[model samples]
Target: MNRKLIALDLDGTTLNDVQQITSETHSVLNKLRDQGHIVSIATGRPFRNSHYYYKQLEMTTPIVNFNGAWCHNPSDKDWDYGYHKSLSRDLAISMLSLKDDPEVQLIAAESRDGIYVHGDYVPYPDFFPDGVKVSKQLSSETLLIDPTSVGVFTNTQQNQSKIEERIIKHYGEAVEVRTWGGFAPCLEIVAAGVQKAMGVERIASYYNIDRKDILAFGDEENDYEMIQYAGHGVVMKNGNDKLKVVADDLTGKTNHDNGLADYLTNYFNL
Candidate 1:
């Protein structure tokens, strides 16, 4: 059998509704790895937030984090093929300026140091991990370095759309914007041309795996490029409707029902 490279998006995909990987999914992934298939995570989450899951899976392959703004092999300190793309400090400052709008409740920037939040807003504790500092100011002077990604949070869907539109219009060709639904109204802004597909392509090239031998799984706007790039793009049953339209196939079960395990079990004939 030809070994394949499998990329998984964490939230609302591999991870269930309760934010835990089910035993069934875990076993299936382990079985795949045992069969010599390479499995890696491609997520919009930062390294700090996604590290726990990466460790849980015992993955040695490079991880795609911050929606492809950062990619690195956590297990290999000597690996020099890592990619870390960030928005320019000026562009980051432009994004941070959105906090002035009343519709924009909060804005945050992620860097190697930590997540710097602007304005009078607070994120959940889980959003900030150990050693990841959380600051109240994200000014140009304070942001000594460029940011991997910037996030805008709004109180309503309408506001979310407005902010996204405003930013995209003002920062055209400078950044990519994506919105998240179902939970809080939020938008993730990253450097131009940054996408999960880029990370997948880089890893595939490094491993000498053809695109046709790649399988990707995702469920949200951030996963768009990756799902389209993969030979077999599997979208969750509970995935965004837009994503489902472009997927090669859809899982019969939802995330809460072990969707990933069920799909891989049949696909690999495990």
Candidate 2:
């Protein structure tokens, strides 16, 4: 179509199941860049985790990280040049009431700086990585630190009602809590206004591209808004069955099949 910008989600959309890009996909992305299509990444992952893929794609567009809590200028050094914008502090406090159980690991985080893992679980430093991990033991008491947003990780994926109830209670009107996906019933908390849509909007504003000229691809809960906002949103064959209901088009293969790269390669190779 006439799309000039492409906002891609990394984990479930761009990368394969193994969380790596196939050379075919990589090569296609390189070609997309050469063809002068603005490509950027919008993800729920922290900025650091998001960079891992941006580097792989050699992306040159701004990155929307933490579901739009922050945006990074692609031209800057790997993790540098991030701009912060988020919800109010009291709203965060109001959201905490949604926690169903104190045993759950509740943590708020800064995009690249760190996370406060609150719970009985003692997370080792490796869980976070080089710069994002705070250099101290996780606090055991009820934490009030304003992280970019709160996150919950548990080993239980069943009991949908309990999980949804907790999310509704904690975030209710102040914050937005969505159960991203986990066989373990994990949830993600972001400022009410923070989402992939916001990130894409920011990126478009920066480049002056209208929503009608942007193309996006994704296949998950976090991807819903971004995919819907783009002019031509594509969903993968392997994406969740529910998302296909909203896709503008469907790619023929799965990530493992290098579907994304294949799409680009075939288009340009024509």
Candidate 3:
């Protein structure tokens, strides 16, 4: 059998509603790995937050994190083809300015150094790495170091939409913005041309796997580019409606039902 690369999104895709990988899904992934298939994670989460899952899966492949703003092989120090794109200082300041808007609750920036939270925004300890700094005053000087990604927090969907629109209008040519609805209604801003698909392409190229030999699984707006780029893009039953329209196929079950394992079982005839 031909070796294939499998890219999976964590939240709302690989991890069930409870935020845990089911026993069945775990077994299926292990079986495929043992058979020489490449299984890796492509997620919007940062390395600090997603590293635990990578370790859990025993993945040696480079991980796609921050929605492709960062991709690197944690276990391979010699892998130098990794990518870590960040927003410009000016752009980061422009986005951080949104903290002044009444509708915008908070602004958070993630850099290689640490996470910087501005205003009333307080990230849950579980999601953020240790030594996260909180600043009541966010300025261009404070964000001089370019960040991998910036997050704009808002309470209402309307505000989230407005924030995304404003950001795109101002800096659309230099950056990309996507709303993360699975969690809070927030806008995830990254450098332009950054997407999970880009990360997958890089990893596939490194492994000498053609696009046709790649299978990707995802269930959200952030997964759009990846799903479209994959040879066989499978969307979960519980995935977004927009994703379902563009997906090559739909899984038989939702994430809660071990959809990934089920799909792979039938696809690989396991």
Candidate 4:
């Protein structure tokens, strides 16, 4: 096979139920890297929460974080061919209004600057690395810089959807809103037209690869655009039903069952 680019979505597609990559999956990925295939992460998580996995996998490729709101290569400080598209600071401040709703628990924003939170809720506590803190309160005054993404965490799925509708209705032209799948009931907002595929495309160009050689895996609504853009869009068996409809293939097993590793092993004859 030619040198293919593999884009992985972290949460429900790559990590198991406990949020750890299985040993079987790890071995297969390492073997692929040895074979000269490019592997990179495309996740809705902020880099702060997803950095451990990137280093653990020993990836040198650019990673798409915050669902492609930010793309940067952690391995090369000198790599200048990446982008960070952030929401206007005023828009981020305006989003804080959602926090006033009874069902909304927290509203947060993240950027290379820092994490700003309006409430105490930390959705994925384990994902955060040590020394990283939710230090600043999210507000017009404290949120001095534009954030790559804004998150609204709610108490229930109904309320989450409700808030998503409200955001679309109000800031339809300014942002793109998506609800997270599997683990939590929250909504993710980024600049209009921002998606993981954009980041993947940039990385593929950096590696001199074509779109037909890209193999992307994901399991959520946020993964929709990236999956559509990839030549081989593989969704986990446990992925959202709507995503499965558009995916080119589905994994034989769920993420917890080492589904990605199994499929890659057979697909590449590794």
For all predicted structures, in order, the TM-scores are 0.93, 0.80, 0.92, 0.96
Instruction: Please provide, for model 4 over 1-270, each residue's C-alpha lDDT reduced to its tens digit, 9 standing for 90 to 100.
Output: 899999999998789988998889899999999999999999999888898888888788899999889889988978888999999999999988887798888788888747888887766656446643646888878888888889888887667777888899999788988777555677989999999999999999999999999999999989999999999999999998899999999999999999999999999999
Tens digit per residue, CA lDDT, model 1, 40-94? 9998888877888988888889999988988889999777878899888888887
Best by TM-score: 4
User: All models: lDDT?
Assistant: 0.85, 0.66, 0.83, 0.88
Better of 2 and 3 by lDDT: 3
Model 3 compared with the native: what TM-score?
Answer: 0.92
Predicted candidate 2 versus true structure: per-residue lDDT over 1-270, tens digit per residue? 444787877765787766777787777777677777788888777765566677767766788877777787856666444566655545544544545564455444343555554444433322455644453333334334556765666546444447667667755776766555533345667777666877788778777888888878887766777777787788877776677788888888877788887666665572
lDDT comparison, 1 vs 3, better candidate: 1
Whichever of 1 and 4 has more lDDT, that candidate is 4
Predicted structure with the largest lDDT when compared to the true one: 4
Assess the local accuracy of residue 227 in candidate 4 as a C-alpha lDDT between 0 and 100.
Answer: 95
Clashing pairs in 3: none
Query: What shift in Å separates residue 106 of candidate 1 from its native position after superposition?
Result: 2.3
